[model samples]
Target: MNLVPLDLDRDLELLHAWVTHPRSHFWGLQGADPQRVRAEYERIAADPHHHAWLGLDDDGTPLFLAETYDPAHSELAEHYPVRPGDLGMHVLVAPPTRQRSGVTSAVMRAVMDFCFAQPGVDRVVVEPDVRNEAIARKNAEVGFVEERHVTLRDKVARLSFCTRTAYAMSAPHLQPAAIAYAHRRLIAKAIAEFSHERLIEPIAEGTGRYRVGDLAFTARRYALNHWVVDADSLTGPLDALDFIAGLRETLGIPEKLLGTYLEEISATLAGTAWKVTHRRESAAELVHADFQTIEAAMTEGHPGFVANNGRIGFGLQDHEAFAPEAGRPVRLRWVAVRKDESLFVTAGDEREHYLAELGEPTLARYERQLRGHGLDPDDYRYLPVHPWQWEHKVTVTFAPDVARRSIVPLDEGPDRYRAQQSIRTFFNVDRPERHYVKTAIAVQNMGFLRGLSPKYMQATPPINEWVRQLVDGDEELRACGFGVLRELASIGYTGDAYHRTGTPGAYTKMLAALWRESPVPRLAAGERLATMASLLHRDRDGNALVSALIAASGRSAAEWVAAYFRAYLRPIVHCLLRHDLAFMPHGENLILVLENHVPRRVFMKDIGEEVAVMNDQPLPAEVERIRIDVTDEIKELALFTDVFDGFLRHLAGILASDGVLPEREFWALAGDCVRAHAKDHPELTGRLDLLRPTFKHSCLNRLQLRNTLQMVDLTDQAGSLIFAGELENPIAVFG
Candidate 1:
């Protein structure tokens, strides 16, 4: 209702008109006046017992009156014994709108739901005359049942009650506007396309090599959940060579000496051939490869302990890690298959989920819709499989003889297999705040290519999703930088200040509906704080450089430096690192970002690849709390390394060769971090000592020790670290 306070006198006149008129249905009030209306409204407005708000339709018109009566209020001090989960609420339609079309019923239900949604109230109560047959039916439709009638203020009224359990039984009145449904449908279609492109298309044409559909789309792995080949790809230019030449020509490549710009990486897969013979499922295909190289792409250096993203080398059939920096000794494992070699990462765990979750049991429920929509699952299932490894990835390679003879089984296996998730016990331990907080993230400032140039749009903030989590789930939006923008009101925002311009404008009051439902959640900043801190402290030596500096210098100097950083720097680094956080831990803005990663407090510093618990007095049961339940498990995002040398490796060469900052500057950066949050969180400020390490502590400048030092004498003692590595060629430069 525009969220504006009701015009009490006007509303009273309208109500009085309805009741006194013989045509009135719900109300038959004896009397009401301007003064009486003001007095009643004041009582409601001021009454702690009553929570009153107006309901508005999609167009922001006032729809009805909504208010809740909860027993916990200070005014309702002697109110009846309210249960741990209980609430009461009601809705009165604005007169001249006698149609109780689901909206009013929903309004009443929403008020009751809001009451129950609060931490305490649970049950809702309403009273109406039983003789009003229409209202009785409406209340019943809203999951309200007739209780006993009571004489209150010497007036008999039939009482009714509603419960959370019963709200679902009632039809919901409040709903997303039609536009929202349209948007959701659009999004769903996009998701469908991605699923089809990445995990469903069969007989897809490869840019290199011939299209599998050339021999008819009878591949056995067509139903598998990887590398789906879109049949459309079959019609494109034959190979990478053709595609590249055409691309260059379109980009206006000079005709002269075009050959000098490009080089062939590998010979064509055209020589290799595959065909689908009589197949049970189209996913089955027999392939013959004239193999040259069959090794996994080194996306990561090579991981031995797959859980920890690290480098590993092949030691015959066994795997050995070559971290040369880990010192002492390197570890080796005898696992049969590495992550890259396998079509799916894990077979047992993810297979269990696939078979149980989106498996037949689940698919059956949606099969009618599937069939009704004319979906052939097999045709839509082979998208993400590499052209060569499509079927062989999940099962075994099929020879022409076997393909012609053996009946292929359905492609039933896992795609993203995680061994850690196989166990029934291990779940949700990753998030300590699993019970109370529900989280979501909005991709803010969404800049996408509208035509050619990218245009900016904002996501409807995920605050509503966050509020839902707090009310119904355990997740939360831990993403940083959630609410820095102004309300959509000002110019460049919402132009509601100009009278003529603002007349048909967005109202802050009405926007409250969106804002109320969509609350910008307080970033549950601990994990991000921890990750950022780790990045700041990350030294090539695998220790924190900022920590070491603060230990050497006293707190006061650190305070001054930290002040400059917070005021002049951190914000920029925070914004930049947000997207590529996996790599941001590197000192990107040089020491600028390192200083920004500093946080006010460090709750979980010991956090690493593994999860652990460390509370003062061990809350044994707390670890198994409902928050971290079976349905909730954290997925690791540190699976890929899209970097060549990495930040840690380069720091030493850069510092020691020709471009090192002075030792004093190092301390200044550490001091800057210490001072950033010193004022408000003094305890954390005091713990600056805990951050530092002694030079002799062995976890010293890792990059420095890795190579010989090249020093350039600096007059300013603070710049010594910078001057040390003043080499024309440092170890690694930021790419």
Candidate 2:
């Protein structure tokens, strides 16, 4: 492609045809006459600060129109401060004669290259209309960081900027230094988690020195078999692939699964490298940042899993467009499925919920689309799908349904969503109060294919409703503001061909989604939301976000942790002993509501699949699937392994390493919280032992290592757990 100065007279007809097309409505010149187009270009030509260019192909055919101006002298200066060397840019691709792949992206890259090539240009500014989400995503592809909305002369626009350094880092390949840095950090994590699980025991060489194979590192042993490995002190191959390969025998990874495991490791390394190169905020800055900002700023994923970020099906482009850490806004693709072939369940009026989720205008548009396809709107239900899943899986695997009009593809939804750390769930960034849409994608991530079982989704809402009522009726829970983000609705499409296979696997579980309640509406005045995973976040400079939050709250580290336990741990304990219920309250599965940077309460999510009634508690017929029979010993592991070893041990290690709090004090505060809760409810004091000396060590990496495809049976998770011998309960000493 080539860029040349656009001639107002010679290019007038071509430019008019391109800008006046209906698809170019965002260009703000739709239905304009040729003369009107000429007047606009003439004004730009007369101005010394602005210039227009025509992008042409090898055959000299016009492909796109580009514009550049000096932001200091433009209308943008009125909204925000403009730096010296800031260049403003706009690009509009010509209406396509046929469907072409990567054309718009190519044109965008060309425009970015042209702008940065200017003599004084150091940053490129763009103000795309806020409603034009397609253009906003395109802008983000080239590394534009969105600021706030600015009112321009014609429309409200999202002001964004891209620095030369950021654009370079957004490239597909990482710099050598970044790759090496990511490898060292990942190698350290692998060593730590593996040793903790007793997969590869590190030989003690000297004080705080250990050797794994030929690799040597300095690490401190903490409570609950935790290893705090120092990344800088690690010596040997810094490549995560080689590191995993060296321990394949000891990890007990089968020969057939080794290659796939290595692929996961590579993907994890690439993701870490991208985050290391593109991180924009420090730990302190994230302390005051908004909810989504702190969420995407999280660097570590599932402190236990070594290959936690192994999005195996995503290509380089998908990583940039959908990865949570990428911080890109996404628009979900909507589809209409025949009512007979789909199931829709809700806790409230379905039509009213749909109208709110997809505004009235969008709902009307979708109804019109169905009528155009010669189908009645009342005969079908609407469902949202991940764009990647729709393009890659639905279009091909469900072709029979598409061809028969059982599943008709509609346009993208208007609201923009951001992928959460869980990857399948999305938060509505455009409308904060809207429900979180969790879609199914048949991509293999950490331990299993990330697909929602449509059969199981049938009872999701009822299970959530049951749990909601239980929490509301508990006096202590209501006082603490501990609640759940209910999975209020669900919809799933079953294809005829795959449905008859009688197999329950990824293929059968492809097209399903659930709507979970958003935490935004539950917030009080002066309160903010942050994912509990942010507590484990350490910035590129080795600063902990949790430590920063403690300092901001004007409380000592011990005091802040005590408050956190009240908000987070006490509820889980209450539900277990008081209600005979167990929830998978891992960091990613929880949300913390904060005021003045101190956690006041918590919200648990991912309910239908993760929660269980461990004992013989009577449940509603619709929610009976959650009932699980387990041994008393295994029931105790719910707190000992999941809460203590899985989550708090890691938190203790981080605080101790940062010198903010001692591990002993951290465990003591936790014990005090549990004891205080027991004191308040005297009848529940002896129901469960909180100070057990030891509990079976539940191994997470072992599950993934055994079967990278499907780690555990969803229906019998507790029965399928892989366990190492035992771990000493950290809080036992407090008793």
Which model scores highest in lDDT?
A: 2
TM-score of each: 0.24, 0.80
Q: 136, model 2: CA deviation in Å?
A: 29
The number of the candidate with the highest TM-score is: 2
List, residue by residue over 1-735, the lDDT tens digit for candidate 1.
133455565466553453344544444334654566557666877877676666665346566666666645533323344455555555666664432223545455445555566775545676666677766776776578776765554335666777867865553322233223222222222222222223122233444222322222211121111121223223322333333344344323345423322221011111001001000011000001000000010111111110112111112111111111111121111011111211221112533423432346544433343345454433221111111122322134223212432212232222221111000001112222211111111100011000100001121122222222222331111221122211111001121122224343212111010111111122343222112212222221223333433333344434633543443233322221221111112221111211232333211110111121111323224221111111101100110111111232222222222223432353346334334434434443432132222111111112111211211111221122211111111111110
lDDT string for model 2 (1-735, tens) is: 689999987899899999999888989998899989999999999999999999996347899999999998899999999998899999999999865445676688779878888998899999999999999987887799999999999999999999998886667336577689889999999999998999988999999999988789999999988999999999976788988987888898888999999888888989888787665468888999898988888888899999888999998779878999877899999999988888889978988989989999999999999999889999988999999999999999998889999999999999999999988899999999999999999888997889987788999999999999999999999988899999999999875687878777778789999999999998999999999999999988788999999989999998899889999999999999998899999999999999999999999999999899977777889999999998778878889888998899999999999999999999999999888998899998778877888888899999999888778988788878998898888888755
RMSD of model 2, in Å? 12.8
Stretches of candidate 1 off by over 4 Å are 1-31, 71-84, 97-101, 171-735
Candidate 2, residue 732: lDDT:
82
Q: Rate residue 443 of model 2 by lDDT.
A: 84
Give lDDT: candidate 1, residue 504: 31
